[model samples]
Target: MHLYDGHFGGMHLIWWIIWVILLAWIFFIPADIPYQKTIKDSPLDILKKRYAKGEISKEDYEESKRILNSDN
Candidate 1:
């Protein structure tokens, strides 16, 4: 057995203790968050709702609906 020198031995022991604590902390932490469901409305549905509410003209509504449906 080696006698404890003042320099390298104390530093090595301190580093090892720190490393173990860090590893334990990493292993025990929760990985997943709770899921929340949000209501997602499509653009055409929103346009139709606005049209029904008299927020947009019929021509404008049709134009916007056409634009929303056309992918290319």
Candidate 2:
């Protein structure tokens, strides 16, 4: 039984490569994770923006805000 003998083996090298790849995949490379994409605007927020930009009348903004906030 060769007790490691203070030498690098094939399995040891392969494991090092595997760990490096796994770590790089986990940290360096970017992937689509939750909350990583651009945030979406809620209907109410969009309605407010439109009203602020003069694209929507005040009545339309109020009605849309009510509809969005309604339980139904």
Candidate 3:
């Protein structure tokens, strides 16, 4: 009877350890994490990027920038 009780106690301890390890893994492990890309630019910065990328010529860039800054 004593040996049986001791074995049961050991099993309880093992169960608790397993439970804690599972909880820690769930909290610590980042699963299915989303990918995010950051843009650190304002509208003006975006305009500059477009100009730099040759999407707009120098003359067109300046004209567009002026238009953006001007109030309707």
Candidate 4:
């Protein structure tokens, strides 16, 4: 019935849109938790790193590589 009432209605609609977008953002954004492991490296890749670091012997590296390759 009044201009001020229509303005209030528009404000309420904007508030609802803002809330929906905020909720969608909160639900859709990817979170990288520190404790969760996102396995980006392949098993052989990890084995190669271990061999390079001297954490595993060359013979062990070759044996593990053969086993892993045979799996596929």
lDDT of 2 by residue, 1-72 (tens): 675875657778899999999999999998878867678997778889999999989998888888888946
* Best candidate according to TM-score: 1
Tens-digit lDDT string for candidate 4 (1-72): 686856677887899999999998889988887889776999999999999999999899999999999999
The list of candidate 3 runs beyond 4 A from truth reads: 1-40
Q: lDDT tens string, model 3, 1-72?
A: 586766677887899999999999999887765676555786778999999999989998898889878844
**Candidate number with greatest lDDT:** 4
- By how many angstroms RMSD does model 3 differ from the true structure? 7.0
**lDDT values for all models:** 0.86, 0.87, 0.84, 0.92
Q: Which ten residues in a row have the lowest lDDT in candidate 2?
A: 1-10
Q: Comparing 1 and 2 by lDDT, which wins?
A: 2
Looking at candidate 1, the ten consecutive residues that score lowest on lDDT are 30-39
TM-scores of all candidate predictions against the true structure: 0.48, 0.47, 0.41, 0.47
**Clashing pairs for predicted structure model 2, backbone only:** none
